[model samples]
Target: MTNRNIKAIKWFINTQLLGKWYNVAYATFKVTSKCNLKCTFCNPAYYSGTLEEGSTERLKKVIDNLRDSSVVVLSFEGGEPTTRPDILDLLGYAHDGSFYVMLTTNGYRLGDPSFLSKISERIDFLHYSIDEYHWNLKALDNLCKFREFGLKVNVQTVVTRYNINTLEDKVKKVRECGYKILLMPAVDYPDSKVKLEPDKEQFYQVLSYLKGKYGSTLNNSWGFIRALKGEFPKRLTSYAITIYPNGDLPYPDDINGEVIGNLSQNKLGELLNSYRAKELRRKMMENSARYEYLHLQTASFNSIKDLAEYAREMGKWAFTGKA
Candidate 1:
């Protein structure tokens, strides 16, 4: 990574925290759970039967509520966001030029040049999911096809036991392919036996190595990277109300606060945050204990004077806060 990008990233992280944007910056909107491929690691029941989704008018109203929210970056995912009949209309709705619209695609349809031509006008970035469970390692070739359309292509590879050992090589290979690589370390499945989640040390080792080595290609913030590497901060599974085509998500899907709100009547913010602050106090505590050590040395960590004092003495290269 160049010195300029590093400075820019640090600046971005500071701006995000100072502005409270990254804390609530991005949201994952499930347009439709109807995916064409059935990968093993995927939960098919999440999006089965007749496709269900919010109409353009309804979704627009949902976006309206987010005005109080500075989350200008929106990631459209699904069972395959493109499957929605109104995909273009939905993209157009989000195309106010103020928001960064990203799509997490499996790349099956992207192989067709026509598809890129259609959506290239709308999306800012195209996030391609290529991992073991999705079984689309070869999708990189298809991804390269879209670059010509000028779609900023980023590949998300969820590193798992079956593939973690080879991730570095994969990153190298992905870089050679001319696309940014965002590494999503695999998470544990609550019901699974083998527990695909890697050991904490191993996870940190990989993240730390990457942060120091390919800091540029890793799309996640440096403070976040350091937080994971230095202390294995208890990760707060992101807060996004991922509604399926049926407009339902399993309770406790990922975060402390989330809900499948009926935007038709309910205020999206109130419905999601209706739970009292006390409800999340425990999770916040857990996160602090797990991750507070990583950001000790950064300017932002010290700048968090309102939050704490000792967070200053912490250490160099600590991942205590910020990203």
Candidate 2:
């Protein structure tokens, strides 16, 4: 059997039989915070902090730490991972077949055929961010080109008020191009002057329309789509964890809370099962209906001040139905 298949089997055993609830199914690591373009909907620095990046040696350590965990799929993200000089080396180090290694890119460096030729071999798939906000609408033309390079591709489009009206058309385009697309709502950071979130009714309408018309082409599960629309009845199973560039665990299993532990200083298992993590998980299990709190952490809030503000808003909306 292939190494990946073996890993998949092991993951199944660990999460199912062993009941390793903290076994992360998806892990996203930000390799760098430096980007070639500044986006309105997203401030790349908002998540990763300053423009500095993790070095090859540091990244290798992070990868090793992740390998020791129950991470089945690892996706390298960034301000733009392509901006790093040693990204190819990093990708090669993680592409040892233990886990599916994916890269999320802005596609600025993808225009060069030679670059793609080199990096394509190291990563399993490429998630290209193509949306109106990035000013890279032409990126749609390169979907087939990525397929030609033998690289599996998925388009990640951030939905906002500006593009809500045209999302159905974009879904059609993605389907026509024969690639899957994951639609995520635009997160209005606590500090941003402009809140780009689409109107709640409009957001729900778009997601419902896309979920119905393009279910096959959409990457989000029905539960996730509903959760996005604030319809959280049951606890959403969160298997995705994000590690910041500095080795801090933002939210293990996407539950918002304090940094569990720095991978550089601690083992993944120890941190995931730490008292703090267990408490967070317990709180989530007990009050899984309040998905808004769970989601605020996933939306890239960097400070407690902002998180608290949003939490108040969520409470207001949830209790009094007024925001």
Candidate 3:
């Protein structure tokens, strides 16, 4: 590749393309598990999930293995990221000015203008969740108030059968609230009892409208659309890793997939290799119903193919209306 092309490729690898690469493009920093609200749909298990965090020193060791790539973004989430005592210090600790720092929050805290002012200084993008779990479409105002400093704010609305029909109107109103919006498919969470999966036709019809307005910025990608359409060819592995609060590593924490070694005691690269070498990877790869579901939501794999498959399954949909 030419110098310009190489730079362009690396940029994509760090951002949009990181999902496909084994390298860490996004780190969901679970600052702490203490949340301000307990949504009915959120599992108590995830909230009670491990509470350990890698210190700055250990975090740097994780970064060292990143090879020639820089971690493009580190997302701070909860219980409530703002609840963590080291919130500001952790923000300052990781601010190298190269990567973007973002947070996915519930907006109960952002209504305080004083806190908004402080957070706007370090966080690049602020994402607020609105869904059946969050149970309201009205928190957009709190996010919009931060516009004065040019802080990027985005909306994340998870779609379910209960709310799918109303998404269009909510989308327009949220757009007027002044931040970009993201339409997400509700994952198969236990508390939901899997009742929230949108009807396939209604879901796609919603996507038809979303794609019309937001283009590629609609959060869910075309591949995600294809998956919702049941075009998934075979099970896939995830390139992403989730190290819980207490430092235990779970293969696909979102779906309660499988457990791998903990980050505090074992390294990710070595653990992946050894786990697959034990014939466990083949068991999941060959197709067992239980493993297939686990693989879909959170599968542990030994190869890049696993990550690619997982990315296709646990696909992400995020967008900014930065104009």
- Which candidate number maximizes lDDT? 2
Candidate 2 deviant stretches above 4 angstroms: 44-52, 229-233, 253-255, 283-323
TM-scores, each model vs. reference: 0.72, 0.82, 0.72
Model 1, 169-274: lDDT tens digits are 7677566645667776555444555556556567667877875676545554444555554533233323233444433432223233344455445554454444
Off by over 4 Å in 3: 1-21, 48-71, 190-194, 233-237, 254-256, 277-323
Quantify all predictions' global Cα lDDT against the true fold. Answer: 0.55, 0.69, 0.56
Query: For candidate 3, which ten residues in a row score worst on lDDT?
Result: 290-299
Candidate 2 deviation (Cα RMSD): 10.0
Ordered by lDDT, highest first, the candidates read 2, 3, 1
Estimate, for each residue in 178-243, the C-alpha lDDT of model 2 and write its tens digit.
Answer: 666777777676677888977767776777788788764665545555555665433334556777
RMSD of 1: 8.1
**Root-mean-square deviation per candidate:** 8.1, 10.0, 6.3
Worst 10 residues of 2 by lDDT: 293-302
